[model samples]
Target chain A: MDWIAADWGTTHLRLWEIDADGGVSKRLDSDQGMGVLDPSDYEPTLLGLLRNRLPEGRATRILACGMVGARQGWIEAPYSAVPIAPLAATRAVKAPTRDPRLDVHVLPGLSQAEPADVMRGEEMRIAGVFASEPGFDGVICLPGLHTIWVQVSAGEVVSFRTCMTGELLGMLSERSVLRLSVGSTGWDANAFAEGLDRGLSRPEALSSSLFTLRAESLLRDLGPEASRARLTGLLIGTELASVRPYWLGQDVRVVGEPDMAEAYSRALESQGVAPKILDSEEMTLAGFRAAHEALAAHAH
Target chain B: MDWIAADWGTTHLRLWEIDADGGVSKRLDSDQGMGVLDPSDYEPTLLGLLRNRLPEGRATRILACGMVGARQGWIEAPYSAVPIAPLAATRAVKAPTRDPRLDVHVLPGLSQAEPADVMRGEEMRIAGVFASEPGFDGVICLPGLHTIWVQVSAGEVVSFRTCMTGELLGMLSERSVLRLSVGSTGWDANAFAEGLDRGLSRPEALSSSLFTLRAESLLRDLGPEASRARLTGLLIGTELASVRPYWLGQDVRVVGEPDMAEAYSRALESQGVAPKILDSEEMTLAGFRAAHEALAAHAH
Candidate 1:
């Protein structure tokens, strides 16, 4: 029988149908996000989208990940603890749906110890990354709104830390007072590196440093984009100050979107460390498949 | 001759009319603020309000301070250095309006040497604060959205540092994902202190700590107010880290609104230092008034 796997996040959603051997044959997209969506709407929306993707008379079992397990998602499959492997959450539930042969299961998310953070879809990808290479002991950094630094040892997540770097940058650029002082787009690698340096040097002064963009623009006539760069430098530099303690003198691996992967690696490079990149998409997909296998065993 | 001095901020507008002796013969208030008014409407609205307030057929000189002098306001005046003195931004203009005799002057702001930040109306206030305490030595702390810590020596506004303490708290309390985690009202002193301590201790971890509030509320039931306190603690504590180093082992003076003064003093106390509170309103007004007197020398 064919099966389906989904990765639903805050801003978007993606679904894929996998054959019995785990090869993806069909895929789907929708705006029905779990971010603002009501828990009750999860099944109907997923099934609605799922029905459209399948051929006539096709029987399918489905596994879903991402925010579909968050507080606002379907059934609220709460997050679990460290060494939190794929299928770590308690046995998956065969979500009751209107279509008799359509089996839907939501995967439980993963959490880490020390610094203390959690992840959902990525855990699957980490498992997938590890599936390709067993006994991988190192740090896997997932960069995004919530940048997670997951420590894996002996094939399990040991500990992690979360940084709202992207979210902070977004809020400052789009929603906060800094919004008044920044431009839409520009890149200055030198300015970015300068900011990274400052963040590492005097991190405590971060919040106050944010207002400097406005002051410098008004006082020194620093152009808007330059002021924007200064702001980014200030925040990134400050983050480096705190996180550098854990990451410095260590080998790091990044598993995320390409651009983000580059930025994350560059951030590590500023501290004189090198970081490798892994496939974030595959990380989540492999995690969902791991859960799928676990579910199959329970059914048998 | 009659004159007017106005200190208009984001939420409110305050104007003081002075006689030759600098005595307040009249005062006016309105909801017209740069935060609320359209940039294009400032001239018409300001003139309309002032014209109505003037004695019939009488002319009065007007001076403006605060955000009204920002880019969106009457005119963009640049920032000056600290000890910018009362008369610094003295190229006061006769704002073009239907009434030709009405002269409006916009005060240029001041920037500090340490911590690299700037201020507008508060500059005049810092002057006044220094003038009032002629021979004071130590740090004078101004608490607000951007908290300024000014160091004074020999009756001069030496240098200062700005902390985005208040703004960060407002963001966490109102706009962040933690908003729901923290209830609307109720300020927990314990939580506030915790935040101050944490902020002071590991300020770099702040962006991540903010998200932890949400993670925690989901993990365990953080009572509405406690969660609020945690968010508050996170912000203030972060600021304490920034400001404490300067005040530690040194006497610090607290300025501004009383509650704000109290918060600063408390943050200082956590660092084993006691702070003295001063009248921030009186400081700013006196600063402006001093600036007015210094400017009056050239007016005649």
Candidate 2:
């Protein structure tokens, strides 16, 4: 292996060793995410994870993305303002390391000022999507903890907005009053469809409808599966109501894990739109490769 | 003291000892709310709090309202459907207690089937407001962890809706991503007003606007106090937008704790709706008194 690609997020760190032939030779995963380590500990944590994977030669170059580039991360790769390419080689920042046999660069995130939003690791993943399908226009929906809806044109991220639907759902299900009514696993298609219609037509009643899940459970014995599914549908439905401009009568692509992509696909389909779902991991690796190649081309 | 008035809810237990002349002789509070107790523990918990306050008599009558009547409570008091008077003495359930000295009556909560909503302690508090002003024909806004808007006519609750604004704000401020940007105490009138306008005008953009708070804090150095105030404005603003039908062209009365009522007052005032702020504790006590008097009248 001549180099490495890393996705260092808040909760998890994943690394892929890239051979000279542009192929991943090995992969490593760890719990040593940016959130857990102090500033000074970043270098040691990375070195520990890269110990046996290092090539027996000069310092090995590691291209990294995500929270590792945050202000609180190893080294602050200041956010690259939007209306620009997702991954810019000039924007990547160098991480300070005491070890002589290691070299690392953390990619910058993307930020928008008007609507006021910032994205870290997702930028690279979006860049990967662009790498695979160059000149792609229209909307790309990336679902996760903070689901992002990006408007792309001419292979550039024009504008984007993020919804805290996933995070809010997790909080409501685990910490809020609704936790008792909703369970962890279940799928009720009927209830989900009902919630979707309610949320889309009456976004204003979102707050009141949330409590209805619990009330119905107590009064009418609404099943746990239905409550859980309805909660998901309601949130996604409200999100769709807001981002109508992005998905309505537009060519849409959802890039995410199978489950999340399927969820977004289902929501979009409900709104009379069919979105092409793409594998997120492949797009992510392609994004890393794009950035790595951009740096290599710059070096050449 | 002649008798006791208690407001027991999910997480709190409050009691007021009433003299023969209808004056509060003493006040007591405990964390032993319905949530922390099993059915068998309710009597012992109540006895522990009423240890020294019990008046010497054949049996002390305790008029209680709230979740002490919930299914998981001491004994299910059963909910009285809405489009009815706030407190129905006929629906009050007698709790089975081992202590002969304690005669406890737990008032039923109010429930609505259509929109699927319920209110426990707030019902008694509203009843108290109705007791003082017997013909309140407009909207009664009770702000708390879960704010309730009750449409009243002829001293009866016609319909109601509950918004999880306060609880959502709490979760976001203390547990969500915005926690880092918002503070516990701060008042930015300008920020709050801006947030209100933003929320009311484009409630669909609420989720995106929340992330903007954090982004602005990081990118533009938005202060903690301003962020907190903006967050409050956004939630209350969204709530006002949804409950516009309740307060659009009607006289409004806000019944809640001082701080929460004040917050609601400021939000309402921004919308050009000046609401009359009433003391929640007083209303709650008055409601209990009304129920007690009604029970007495029934006996006669």
Candidate 3:
């Protein structure tokens, strides 16, 4: 292996082995995400996973992103200010490792000052997109636990906003009163469409509309499948309503898991906007490759 | 004691011993609420709490309200359709108790057909308000875990809506990413006011505004007290904006605990509406008294 790429998020850690010709040779994933590890545990955890793959006599470069760089993770890589390039590889912070064969670099996340927004792992996806299409300038939406909407201009992230839609949905479905009505599995397309329309038109009624789901379940026997889909639709619709300006007349691309990206596409399509969906894993890998190239160029 | 007035909700069970003259003789409370008890456990729990208070050999009439009448409670009293009197005592359901001395009559809750709304405990507060002022006509707001906005006209519940504002706030503050920013203690009125304005003006930005709280805490050191208060304000403000039609040009009364009622009052006052705050416990007792009177009238 020539190098390694890692995405260490709150709940999961994914790693890819890069070959000499710059292709992914092998991929491994684990549940040892940054959320479960202390600052001092990151090196030991990484070593445990990569001990077999590390070069025998030389330090192997490992480029890492996401919450692994958060204050509570391995080490705090300070967030870079916005209107800056997404792939600032030269600015990556080096983490101290006792093992001679492990060399780790944690990339800095992006932050906006005025509205106070930040992005960690999602920035790499943006970098991946920019790396492939050098002059690409538009809005990019990365939907996940913390959905981010970013505007790219002249190879820089001009500004961005984040919505807690995914987290809210999970919490509401699993912990709130709606838990009884919204189950973990299933989907109902018509119900989703209905909820999406209600959310887009009356965003102010978000809280009340949520209660209706529980009431409908009790009074009308609304099934869990329909309730869950409706909740998903409502949250995404509300998010789309909030970020209309970001995707209204601009070319928009959604980079996320296929299912989630499809939901975003359906919501955007409802508002007369067509968004192209891109694979998030591919983007993250492309981003890591771009960072590697930059690191090698700077070494000269 | 002429009768027993009970308010058995999801989290707590409160009982008031009523004398022949229709006055409260003594009050007792416990944590054995409906959420924790089973169908068979209800009789035992109630008997254990009121064993000493029960009359020697006579059947003691018990008027119970709240979640104790829910489907999951000791026995389902079933919801009474609305556009009808809030205190429909004649429709109360009788529960089968093993102890001959315990005559429990659970009061039915109010439900609306069109909007698909249901309220178990708040109906008592509405009935209590009407018990004092028979000709009362206006909107009554009960802010709690499930904030309810009820419309009353000519002694009948005209219509109503429920908002999960308090539950959403609790889940977000304790379970979501915002948990790091929002603490369980303290208050900041200024930050709350700022959040209120934002929520009222652009409620579509609800999801995004929540993310900003975490960002502000990370970047600018926003205090927990301020974050909590701001979250409270934003939710209440959004609720007020959504239920404007109910309180816009109508007399409004807020029946709740002092602190929560005051927050609702402040939010309403911001929109040029002055709402009268009533003690929830007092209203609940009054509601039971009204139900007792109707039960006596029907028996005679």
Candidate 4:
């Protein structure tokens, strides 16, 4: 029994075909991102991509994740309340028939809490990571466009908080007036660390601190690297203020690319808490595999 | 001799027909904004707009202020260093035009310490505000897109600092990730004050605190009004950090809108300081007049 996993995100579609043991055998990606596709069109897109990878007359159980199960996705999956981690056993949605020998299941992401944040794609990876490890109880942070902090207890996503830290950094650096100050290049790590620390220390002044990026550039003749760091710190500082409580009693595990984790790590460390780093892709695949096995078990 | 005064900015051309006694009889404005006009083309645009505004066939000494003297304006006026305010005696660049009918002099905006931070339009206003009240040696604050803090001494802009407070607020509220959490309409003033105080208190952490806006919204159910306040404080707090040095041992004057002044006033008040509020328009107009006199005297 081979397994197929798809992380259909807003801007990119990533699918991997794996063995029953969650070993990656083949992978394919498409520009037909979730952001580009209509809710009604998700079925054909997923089916077409999965069936393309798996030959006709081969009945393979496929698990799909991400915002694809959103209100506008292939099928609407209601939210799971806080402290109730998204379950491994998701209801199979009725997907369109594009191939004869395919059984598709679109895994629903969890919507927990008001101002109402949701997660689909990453929740799968979170669950999978928890399954692979023992005594995994507490917060797992997945950093991206919308960074998520999952409160896991007994392998469930009981409660989670979403922070759009990356998106804010991008907009401020690339589009806003601060764009002129950051210069053209990768961020300066020192400035980034300092900024992150500054921001976390002073959570209330978050808004005004952003302006100081350009001001510092003009007045102090600070380099682009420092300005970039200032911005990162400003946004992260605000994030710390809100999530400080979550980090107080729980063990924080951070899973993401190294560059991002660098800042979050420093932010947490400054507060006297050290985060456990995990391989981003490995956890993603593990989560995908866990979901596939759960679906298979339910069918029997 | 009738004196001509102009407020030539990045976007619009505003001209005043002033009697020798410094009374304005005619006010004319046009769509010729400094932002869109090229430096070489600025002279032509000014001449074109001034066609009917001036006395027919009479040589009028025209004095202009603002961005008309930036690198892209009618004349390239170099910036004066910080610790020195934009003065009536500040350098005036020659507008490139063959028509002797227009004795045009464009006042230069000051930029100190670097080539990146320069303000062309309001320098004269800062000068005028200081000159009008002699012995007003202190920190004068002019808040806007780039809030200017000028150290005025003997009626001159001695030194200044530029803060990107307003611009950052607009960028974050409109473009940043915080946009998701902040509800734009009907801000909470109390929340703003609270944010301002929190920001100023943790001035060093100004850089990192911005993310709290989104985090509180997601993790702690922080509302838009509170988020808005948090954003404001973040920027304000950073500004306070940079401006605090100049703020001490000086009588302060603020030249801006009342509400913004109130915010500043409260921030200062909390620190046991009170600021004098001046009319922004009056200062600008008076500054323009003073610049005109200086230019006329130089010709004499």
Candidate 5:
């Protein structure tokens, strides 16, 4: 194996082994994300997972990204200020290791000063997008727990905004009063469309609109499927409304899980904006490869 | 004791003994609210709390309001349609009891048909407001887990909207990613005012604005007190913007706990609306008294 590339996020850890030809030879993942580990646990956990895989005679260079570099994670890889390239391999921080065959470098995340925002693992995905389409310029939407919208220019992330839409939807559907109305598994396309329209037209009424779902459930017997779909629609629509300046009259690309990317695609199409959907895992791995190549060039 | 007045809500049960002169002679409370009891558990729980309080060998009439009358509560009192008086004592349902010494009457809640809204406990408080001011014609704001804004005309509930503002604040502060930024206790008036302005002026940007709090905490070292206060301001301000028609150019009365009412009052005042703050407990008890009086009138 030539090297190892890892994306250690808050709730997940994914690793890819690259051969001398720069092709993935093996892939592995674990739930031992940064959220569940102490500062001292990262090296041991990595070593344990890579048992019997590391070459015996030499130290294997492991490139890592994401919350694993957070202040409370394995080690702080201080955020690289933006209006800069997403691949900050030259600025990567080496985490202390006791194992003879382990050499780990955690990549820095991106931060914006004004309207303060920070992203960890997502920068690599942005880098991957730039790798694939070197001249791509416009908004890139990365939807997940903390959805982000980035404006790209000259292969650098010029500006961006983060929306807590995904987290809010999770909390509202599973923990809030709306939980009684919205079931975990259900799909109602028509209800979702209606909710998107309501949210886009009257974003100011978002809070009250949430309560109306519960009221409808009690008074009109609105089914759980419709309720859940509508709730998702409302949150996403509100997010789209807030970020209209980012996607309006611009080339937009959405990189996320298939289902989430599809949802964003539908919402955007309804607003007359055609957004390209990209595979999240593909972008993430490509991003790691780009970072690896940058590190190799610096080494040479 | 002439009779009993009970406010049995989701989380609490508060009872008052009314003398022949229609004044409260004794008061008691319990945490055995409707939420914790089953159909059969209600009778026993009520009996246990009222032990040695009920008159011997004689039936005592218990007039109760709130969630205790919900479909899943002790017994379903059902909901009375709106454009009607808040006090629906004439239509109160009698809960069957095995003990001859118990005669419990559960009051119905209010429901709006068009916008699809329902209120279990707030109706009684609205009735109390009307009881105190017989010819009151204005808007009544009841702030709590489910903050309510009601339009009143000619002693009847004209129309109303329920904002899930308080619940959202709780969920966001205690359960969402914002929990890391906001603390349980502390006050920051200036930060709150700023957030209120931001929320009111640009309600569409709420989802992104919420994430900004977390970023500010990380980047600018924004304290927990300021973050919490700002979160509250944003939510309440958004609610105020949505319910503008209900309070603008109308006599506004806020009925709630001191701290919450004060927050609402300050937000409203900033928009040039002078709202009168009323004691929530006083209104609730008065509403109970009003229901009891109507019951007596019917008996006569």
Candidate 6:
């Protein structure tokens, strides 16, 4: 194996062994995310995941990203200041390891000083987008627990904003009083569209609008499917309103999980913009491979 | 005791005995709110709380308001349409009972058709405000898990809005990633004031601003108290911005728990409006008493 590309997030640890031909030879997945480990446990955790993969004497290079580089991670890779290209080799930090046959480099996340925003793993994903599509320039959105909107130009992340839409929806539907009314399995495209418009028009009423979902469920018998869609729609709608400056009349691409990226595409299409959906897993691997190539070129 | 005045909500049940002169003779409190009980458990729960207090032979009148009147409560007391007086005694419904010793009346909550809003216990508290201050005409804000803002005139609830500020703060602070950074106790008045202003000025950026709290905590080691206060201030600030029309150039009264009502008072004062704080417990009793008296007068 030429190298290993890993994405260690809050809840999942994903790994891929890259061959000399730049192809993924073997893939592995685990529930051991950085969130569930103590700093001392990271080395053992990685070794357990790569039990038979590492070479006997020679060191195996591992390029990792995500929350594993957080301050509380195995080793903190301080954030790279914004308005810079996504993957700069010098910004990567070497993580100390007891196993002599293991060599790991954790990439630094990006940070914006003015709005005080930060992103760890998504930086690599955005880098992958730029690596493949050098001519692509506009807005890039990665929707998840913290949906991120970025302005990219000339192979650089100009500015970005993070919205707590996904987290808010999750908490509201699972923990809030609305939990009793909203169900897990259902979708109402019509309700979602209406809620989106309402949220965009009256963004200030976002909090009140959330409560209305529960009230409607009780008073009007709004089903779980419609309620779920409406709740998601309202949050995403309000988020789009905030980042309108980034996406309006501009080329927009969504790089996220299939379901979330598709949802963003639909929301964007409703607003007269057809957002292209990029495969997030492919982008992540591309970024990791690009970083490995840059490191090899530098050594030569 | 002449009758009982009770406020049975989702999380709490508060009761007060009304003497002949309309004075509160005794007060009782319990955690047995309508939420934890089924239809079959309501009568037993009430009996358990009023064991020796119930009169031996004749039925003792219990005038109750709040979620107890909700569809999922002891018995459904249908909502009274809005744009009507605070106390519509004719709309009250008597609970079917096996014990003749209990004469229970659950008052209907208020409902707005246009925006599809509803309030149960708050209607009684607003009614109490009208009963005491006949000239009170501007706005009444009751802050809680679900804060409510009402425009009242001529003893009628003209129009109202509900904000989930309290619930949002609770979930974000206790459930989101910020929970790890924020302390359970700490305060930064300046940070709170600044956050409130930021939230009010840019309500559309509410979600982004929330993420900034976590960033600030990580980047600057923002203390827990400050994080808690900032989280709360932001939500309340956005809510105030949404309901600016209700409090602008109008008399405002805040009827809620001391801490929350005081917080609202501070926010209002910052906006150059001095809001009067009324004891929510007292107001609830007064409204319940008023409803009971109206029922008695009709019988006479």
Judging by DockQ against the true structure, name the best candidate.
5
For every candidate structure, what is the RMSD over all alpha carbons to the true structure, in angstroms?
3.0, 1.4, 1.5, 5.3, 1.5, 1.9
Worst 10 residues of 4 chain A by lDDT: A202-211
Residue-wise lDDT of candidate 3 within B1-300, one digit each (tens)? Answer: 999998899989998999999888989999999989999998998889887778878899999989999999988998999999888899899998989899999999988888999999788899889987778999999999999999999999999999999999989999999998998999999988988998899888899999999999999999999999999999888888888898998899999988789999998898888899988988888888888888889999
Q: Report, to 2 decimal places, the DockQ of model 6.
A: 0.72
Per residue, candidate 6 scores C-alpha lDDT tens digits across A98-160 of 898899999889998878888989988898898879867899999988999999998889999
lDDT of 5 by residue, A1-300 (tens): 989999899899999999988789999999999889999999989988888889998999999999999998999999999999998899999999998899999999999999899999999889879988888999899999989999998989999999999999999999887888899996999999989998999999999999999999999999999998899899999888888999888899999988788988999999999999998988888898889889889989
Provide DockQ values for all models, in the order shown: 0.54, 0.70, 0.83, 0.20, 0.84, 0.72
The chain A TM-scores for the candidates, taken one by one, are 0.88, 0.97, 0.97, 0.91, 0.98, 0.97
* TM-score on alpha carbons, each prediction: 0.90, 0.98, 0.97, 0.75, 0.97, 0.96
Docking level of model 3: high
Better of 1 and 3 by DockQ: 3
lDDT of 2 by residue, B1-300 (tens): 878999898899999999999999999999898888999998888889888667565688899888899888888888889899998898888899776788889889899998888888899888888888888789999999899999999878999999888889999999998998999996898998888888888886777778889889999999999999999988888888888998888899999888779988898987788899999989999999999999878779
Give the candidate order by descending DockQ: 5, 3, 6, 2, 1, 4
Return the TM-score for candidate 6, rounded to 2 decimals: 0.96
Root mean square deviation (Cα) for candidate 3:
1.5
DockQ measured for candidate 1: 0.54
Off by over 4 Å in 3: none
lDDT of 2 by residue, A1-300 (tens): 878899999889999998998898989999998879899988888878877667665888899999999888898999989899998877788888877778899899999988888999998778988888898988899998888999999988999998888888899989998998998997888998888888899887777788888899988899889999899888888888888898999899899878768878998998889899989888899999999989989888
Chain B, candidate 2: TM-score: 0.98
B10-66 in candidate 4: lDDT tens per residue? 668888878978888778888788767776676677667667665668667777887
Candidates by lDDT, descending order? 5, 3, 2, 6, 1, 4
What lDDT score is found at residue B171 in candidate 2?
A: 99
